[model samples]
Target: MADPKGFMRHARREWPRRPVGERVKDWDEVYVPGGVLPFVEQQAERCMDCGVPFCHEACPLGNLVPEWNDLVSRADWHAAAERLHATNNFPEFTGRLCPAPCEAGCVLAINQPAVTIKNVEAAVADRVWADGLAPPRPPERLSGKSVGVVGSGPAGLAAAQQLTRAGHTVVVYERDDRPGGLLRYGIPAFKMEKAQLERRLAQLRAEGTRFRTSTAVGRDIGAARLRARHDAVVLAVGATAWRELPVPGRALAGVVQAMEYLPPANRVCEGDLDVSPLSAAGKHVVIVGGGDTGADCLGTAVREGAASVTQVDIRVLPPAERDEAVDPWPVYPTVHRVSPAHEEAGELRFAQDPDADARLFAASALRFSGDGAGRVRAVHLGGVDARRRPVPGAERTLRADLVLLALGFEGPEVAAGGAVAELGVAVTRDGTVARDEEYATDVPGVYAAGDAGRGQSLVVWAIAEGRAVAAAVDRHLMGATSLPSPVTASTRPLRA
Candidate 1:
């Protein structure tokens, strides 16, 4: 600390987002371009540097929050970035997308607003990127141990980077035409522009991380063939089999899975299409789910010029404040917080459709109906109680020219014939890949990480697992290694 009284001296200030009226018309980051650095530095001083530092406990990567807070407060951007990178390989992605569980565990949060840790983290990343402090760190010597990292999402990318930096020749494989996985195709541009992802990928390339995009391991080349080329393999393919509604009219033309709808929409941003075939333009769009993916659809619908957009969630609405009784401090509490997408969607509904509420909590979708042309026309939904029991006379129909299912995923998908099934990987009851505490699968030289091994979870957890699995792979190849261990495959906060 710069100042012990910093939290008291300054009120929490957030980065200014562009005007809603102006931002909804385009697909770009919503925050104002510059001039917020001084404010970010000041916010960094709010860390109280507690006796136990519960922030570290809550963070999956065990990020050195107080250390970087001090460094940033002292205007040591380079050192701050280093400390940040020591734990997290991609702070920019976490800073933008993470729910900031560390902030929930902050010492200051007990009495007052927590230090704006997310903002400070993001600012340091942006600062280092602009000043050119982030550069390629190629290994001094080759370990001659080749590792094949399947999937190019956060987990795979992090594992490939760490393994490569440790002198191993790492090659990442992605089935998509371009790498970056969901980061490039699933997430909307307004949340995180693809440029940040691409910049880091270029650094990975310079550091000798080879990438083979548009090549599915089990499809393009046999799994045994892939294993033959590499000494070891890291399976980081994420949980992608989305949940579906089994109600009637599901086969209608306009009904699509969230992942299916989002990829083409993202491809439109990359200039692959002048207009997405699944575009919600001039249509009444209804999304089913209450999670971030649903909100992503909500924002995308607004940007696509939908006539109206609405979401129905079966779960009860989250409490405005943390539920101290059931979910005490140091845990990632389930609470209501508005996302950037909610802001855009809120404006769109308020301006375009005055009669509609953009989101419905304590509601469940019953069925769907189609028009004569075999296109989805309406969705039938009903209000639900705390236990998801239907409320009396609460059923209603909503206009839905385009229906998108933003429901959560159902663990790893292996049955439809992929690398996991091809390699004889064991799966848990919930459909996640089975691994030992060391993240080693039943196969001797093959390992797993991210959603594939851990089930569907947060990005921070994926990054931590990636780091841990890399160390395990390193040790397996070298007998002993010097890699840092952030977490084990089973490590996590209670109920986090």
Candidate 2:
């Protein structure tokens, strides 16, 4: 540790966000430039180097948190970056987007605020990139074996990078025009600028990983043909299916799914599209569901110049502060969180609590009423009780030009004409692709990872799974392999 008394001397300071009004005018990252580093070293010093180090257990990648924290505290930026890269393939992505469950599991969090592990990790990554310390790890010998990776998301990229470095020829296939799946298209630029992704992709290309974009398995090429051409195949297709509201009026013209809305906004940021087809400009937008996706929609609406943005959640509002009994220390808490989007948009409406498990609390979408012009005008809501039954006198109409269904995804979409169906892969009853211990499906030499195997989850989990699955594929291709598997399917954290 840099200073034994550092935690006592300096209070926790987070990265400062840009002024809401200023950030709303553009789709750039929310944080002000150059403000994060000043406090990062001190924050790293706060690590107590606990004997148990619960923070490690909390991370899916099993990142050497204390070692890196010590490195950062000592201002050994290069060493810290190495330690971070030892496990995580994309620290920049996770540092910006992950919820930071490791901080929740920090020993310091038993009472006081936890060390800013996430911020420190990001700082180390940025510093390494600036210092030109991050380099591609080209393999010492080409194994002559070839591997085909489907999907260009975190999992697919991570697996491809690892396999390529292990001396296997690797090819990545992405249906989108560009690589980086959600990283490139599904996520907004404000959360993480595209340049960061592009830089990583450049490094991957340098390391001899080949990318084939605008290609879909079972469509552009038959899945069997892909397997025949390549020695092995890895499927990193993410869960693209959005959990939809089956309630009436979902068919309204102005109502759209979160995935449909987010991509065009990202395209606009890429300068590929002049205007997003689903632009929220000049509209009274109401986002359903209060998860990260919803918050993302809220921020996007604000940037799109929505007349007003309101985010609604059926659950009773989470407490401003964490409740110890419900969420003990060293475990991720179910407390109120204020994301960058939440800060930019000042309205978050919590519907009354519902009694039944599936019932909507304070949730009501009675119907959609549109004008003769064929555009949406208003929405009808009924005050719902615990059972989601409409209250006798709680019916009300709200002006709404746009309704974004920000509800989360259920599983990977496998319907006809959908991405999964086009892939021609076998899926489980729950809709996820079936995979064995090595992440290989029933089809020989074919593998699956990320949301396609584990369902919807954080990016960190996807990266970890990718690394693990890559190791399995490498061993299968060669007689043996040495890639690290930081997490297993059985490693459960205190908090799910």
Candidate 3:
């Protein structure tokens, strides 16, 4: 236990965010610089260290939450980072992007606010980086076996790193010019700066994890050739087939997929583009879908100087507070919480309409209206009843010069699954690659991980899948593995 009375002594508080007016003007991270460290110890002390420690169970990586909380409270930054890395390969990524289901399962959440585990995690990661503790650990001897990973996202990165350290030669293949798959493109810069990602990549490179960028295993080179060059292959390709709104005016010029809109903006941040090709400047932007992707689009639109930003959610607003009856302790709850982007958007719109949340709950899109030149002009939407049926007389039109469909991905595409066929693996009916509990495909010497096998999932889960697959591959080659397998491929959320 951190402190017997620490939960009551200190209230749960998170890192401070920069002023909305100041932050929206730039693409830097939304939080204030060096803000989390001062109070990180205080927040870490709030952990009760329950007998069961549900937070660890909730996390896919099985992070040492209680141990690190105690370490942070005791002012041991190096030990905290060591414990965090014991399970997770990239705490920095999860700290910024993950929804923190571990916090939802916190023992304190039963009666009080959850501990600031995510913030503490970020602080510990940053502390280690600042302390120059991220030196590369090259393998003592070569294992002779080699692996070719087909993605450079979190999962692929994790597998590559683990295999490299386990004395195997690992090469990560990425189709994009840069190594990081979605992390380098899909996410907006305001959420997480690329410097954090670059530094980690530097560590991986120092550790001898080779990255082959702009190389498509299935298209540029044959997958069979790659298999022959390497002992095994691990598919960590993410679920990137963006879903569409199949309605009238589907081909409007201004209406684009969320991937199309976000990647260009990120490219501009990467210095590849002077201006984003899909700039939202001076346009009325409407983002459909209330998930993190929609929030990302909203934030990017706001930074790009959109005139107005509106978000549409198919489901109604979640409860203001956790409902113990429906979602008990240790299960992630449905609660209305304002993300950093939402806060900035709310501030942007507060002057015009104090009550406007810029979100239309339970709203279903009917179709998009296009101008004579085939550019999106407006979006027609209607409210839905409890059963998701259209409500009578609830139709409304919103001005939308730029419409970004943030509806989540539809798993991997067959074209993207080109490597799967070359390796002779089976895909599930739900559009994901089929693998058994060991992440092993029907074909020998080939396996799958991340969204390719698990469908759309969190970054933490992808890393976990990567680690598990690395273990499976290591054992397959060395006849035994010393790596820790945190979760099996069949693991599911406590509550759907």
Model 3 segments more than 4 A misplaced: 350-355
* Winner of 1 and 2 under TM-score: 1
RMSD of each predicted structure? 1.5, 3.6, 1.5
Q: TM-scores of the models, in the given order?
A: 0.97, 0.93, 0.98
Which pairs of residues collide in candidate 1?
none
lDDT of 3 by residue, 1-496 (tens): 7688999999888999999999998999999987998889989998888899999989999999999999999998888888999999889999999999999989888888999989999998888899987788899999999999999999999999999999999999999999888899988878889988999899999999999898887778787788889998998988998888899977889989999999999999989999998998999888989999999998998898988888888987789998889888889898887888888888779212233566778889999998889899999999997578999998988888899999998786656446666666788898888989989888778889999999999998999999999999999999999988887889998893
| Structural RMSD, model 1 | 1.5
Instruction: State the lDDT of candidate 1 residue by residue for 1-496, as single tens digits.
Output: 6889888888888778888888888889888765468588778877777779989988989999999999998999999999999999999999888888898888888768888888888898899799998899999999989999999999999999999999999999999999897899998998889998999999999999999998887788778988899999999999997898898888999999989899888999999999999898999988899899998888888889888888777888789888888688768788876777777777656222242347777878888899898998988988899888989998888888988998888876697458788778889888888999989999878999999988878888888988889999999999987877788888866563
| CA-lDDT, candidates in order | 0.87, 0.82, 0.88
lDDT (Cα, 0-100) at 203 in candidate 3: 93
Q: How would the candidate models be sorted by TM-score, starting from the highest?
A: 3, 1, 2
Query: What is the per-residue lDDT of model 2 for residues 107-146, given as tens digits with 9 covering 90 to 100?
Result: 8988898898888888888997899988988999999999
Decreasing lDDT order of the candidates: 3, 1, 2
Candidate 1 or 2, higher lDDT? 1
